[model samples]
Target: MRRIRRSIGEYINLYNGKRPHSSLADQTPDEAHFGTVRAINSGA
Candidate 1:
């Protein structure tokens, strides 16, 4: 049970703080949730 709980915690961390999602413009869920993304300006 402890191992399963630890695995679940790791998965949650990755899902929320590490893995980027296409629906979020490749931003991790934590970034999207916290509005911490920085915009890149390309010289046009």
Candidate 2:
């Protein structure tokens, strides 16, 4: 159970922090939430 929980947590972190989603215009959840997506594309 503990191992499963750890795996879930890691996946959650990756999902929210690292993985990009097409629904969010290929931005990670954190980037979409913080409005950093434009900055990334505009090269600012």
Candidate 3:
């Protein structure tokens, strides 16, 4: 059960943090949600 939970958590993280979504202009969910903050922090 613990391993299963960890696997699910990892997959969720990947889906949100790494996988790009076409509906979101090919940005990952995290990128789509925090793009401006990221750009500002990076001095873009």
Point to the candidate with the largest lDDT. 3
Clashing pairs in 3: none
Q: After superposition, how far is residue 8 of candidate 3 from its true place, in Å?
A: 0.5
TM-score per candidate, in order?
0.77, 0.66, 0.75
lDDT head-to-head 2 vs 3, winner = 3
lDDT of 2 by residue, 1-44 (tens): 99999999999999999999999999999989877767877888
**For model 2, the run of ten residues with the poorest summed lDDT:** 33-42
Candidate-wise lDDT, in order: 0.86, 0.92, 0.95
Residues 1-44 of candidate 1: C-alpha lDDT, one tens digit per residue: 99999999999999999999999999999998777434333322
Q: Over 4 Å off in model 2, which ranges?
A: 36-44
Stretches > 4 Å off in candidate 3: 36-44
How do all the candidates rank in terms of lDDT, highest first? 3, 2, 1
Pairs that collide, model 1: none
Task: Give, for candidate 3, the lowest lDDT window spanning 10 residues.
Answer: 32-41
Query: Roughly what TM-score does model 3 have, to 2 decimal places?
Result: 0.75
Q: Residue 24 deviation, candidate 3, in Å?
A: 0.4
On TM-score, the stronger of 1 and 2 is: 1
Best-fitting candidate, measured by TM-score? 1
